[model samples]
Target: MENPITRPRSVERLVAGQATSDGAGVKLTRVLTQDLQRRLDPFLMLDAFRNENPEDYIGGFPNHPHRGFETVTYMIAGRMRHRDSAGNEGLLGPGGAQWMTAGSGLIHSELPEQEEGLMEGFQLWLNLPAKAKMCAPGYRDIPPPAIPEYVDGAGVRVRVIAGDSGGVAGAVRRPDTEPLFLDLHLPAGAGFGQALPAGHNAFLYVYRGSVIVRGAPVADRHMAILGNDGDGVVLQADGDSRVLLVAGRPLQEPIVQYGPFVMNTAEQIHQAVRDYQAGKFAAAAVQAF
Candidate 1:
C-alpha cells in the first residue's frame, strides 16, 4: 500500500487556460502556456472543446500540417469527423480516440458532426525524439471499449488511455509513451492518493469540477503542475469532481514550434515547411484522410 503523501512543500505553478478556435468556429480551451514558446518539453499543449450547439464546433479543424509530434484526440460526449491528408478518414464517436503520429509529416483535418448537436473532446500534443522526427506518419483510431477502465474500492473510477497505473494498462503499445493517462473521477468530498512514478513530470487538468490539489484548490479548466520529488500525488474533491491526470518523463529537449509543426531547431522548422512545400512527403496526405 502506498503511504499518503504529505502536503507538497514546493509550490506548483497554477497555469491559466486560454480560449481559442480553429477550423473557423471550433471552440477550444488551451491548458498550458499561452505562447507555444513556453510549452512544456515533452508535452506541447492540451485543448478541450465541449459544445452542444452545432454552430459552435461544427466547423472543425481544416487542412493543416504537422511534423515531429503526435496528435491525440479523445472524444468523450459527442462525435467528430476525421479526415486526414494521408487518406485516413473515420467518424470518432463518443468514447473514441484518434492517435496520430505525424512523424515526418502529415496533413489532416477534423470536423465535428455531432448527432445531438453536441461536440466534446480533447486534443493533446506529444513531442517526438530527434531520430523519429522524420519517421513515416501513422494513426490509431481506438473506440471506447478499447481503452482500459479500473474501479477502486473507494468509488473512484479511472479510464486509462496510456501507461500503467492503478492496475490498468490504458492502451498497450510496445515501449508505450512514457506518459500515463487517466480520466479520474472522485465522489464529492472524497480524498484519494495516486502513487506516481518518481522523477516523472506530471499534472492534473480539471474538466468538470474543482479539486483541492495540495490544498491550493483548483477549479475546472485550470491545470495544476506537480513537483518531481513526490512518489504519489494527493487529490481531494470539493464536489463530484472529474479530472484528467497526464504524467510522463520530461524530454528535456530543445523545442522549436511553429503554428502546426514542432521541431527541435528553427532551421528544422524551415526545412519542414520547405519539404512540405516541395512535396517531400506529399503522398502522406493521401493516407491521412
Candidate 2:
C-alpha cells in the first residue's frame, strides 16, 4: 500500500544532540534540551543513553524530586528498577516502558539492574497542563508485550507507545497533550509514513543507521525537527534504521523550569522547591504500579 502521508512535512533543521551526563554520572545525549522546549510544546526533554560499560551507568539516578510534569522511560535493551515515594516499584526490562506523572510531587529512584552488556534507552519529559499540575501523582509500568505494534507489508515495524498508530492504540494515553510517541524500525530502502495533525509539533531522532525526510538526511544520533507546513511525515530509510517520532499538541502556556521541576510561573517553581524541601511533596499516598 502507498504511504498515508500525502503532504509530508519537510525538515526544518537538523540538530546534533548534546552530550551530557545525568542520574549519577550516567552518560547520555540530550536530544531535546531546554532551549527547544518551547518549540516542541507539551514536551520538555528527551535523553538517549546507550552504554556497554557498567561503570558508565552504574551510579543510576538516586532519589530525586519532580513536580508538574510526566516522565516516560522506554527501555530498548536494559533492566531498570524504579521506586518512588508513593510505594510504586517496577522492573522495566527490554522493550518495556514506565510512565510516571509527578503531578503535585514525588521522589523517585531509577537504578540499573544489570552488571554488564548493552544498556540503551530514552527518557522523555511531558509537561502537564496548568489545571492538572496539582492532581494526584500516577505511575504505570508497561511491559514489552503490552505495547501495541504495527507491521506493514514493506517490513516497517512501528511500536505505538503513547498514541494511536495504524489503528493500534498504544499502552498509555494522556488527555490534554494527546502526545504521539512511536518507535519505527525500517529495513533498508523501506519507507514509513504517519499522519500528524498540522498543528502539532513534531520531530524525529535517528538512533540507528539513517533516514531521509523530504530528501534531507538525518544521520544516526541526529534529530530532525519537522516543519509545521505539512499534515504528516514520510521517512525513507537509507539502511536498516531505527528512529523515534514524537509529536504533541502545544500547551501554549508559560513554562518555568528549575532543575527537575516545571511550572507555568516563577512563583509556582519557587513553591515547588519550597514544597520539596519542606517534605510536603510526598504528603499524600499515590496508587501503586
Best by TM-score: 2
Candidate 2 structure, TM-score to reference? 0.98
Q: How do the residues 79-121 of candidate 1 rate in per-residue lDDT, one tens digit apiece?
A: 7777777778888988777788898898888866654566777
Q: Model 2: per-residue lDDT, tens digit, 1-289?
A: 2358878999998988899999899999999999999999989999999999999999999999999999999999989999988888999999999999999999999999999989999999999999989889999999999999989888999999998888889888899999999999999999888899979999999999999998999999999999998989999999999999999999999999999999999999999999998999767467533
Q: Which ten residues in a row have the lowest lDDT in candidate 1?
A: 1-10
Show where candidate 1 strays beyond 4 Å: 1-11, 34-39, 172-177, 285-289
The Cα error of candidate 1 at residue 253, in Å, is 1.1
Candidate 2 wrongly placed segments (more than 4 Å)? 1-3, 287-289
Best by lDDT: 2
lDDT of 1 at 148: 86
- Candidate 1 local accuracy as lDDT? 0.76
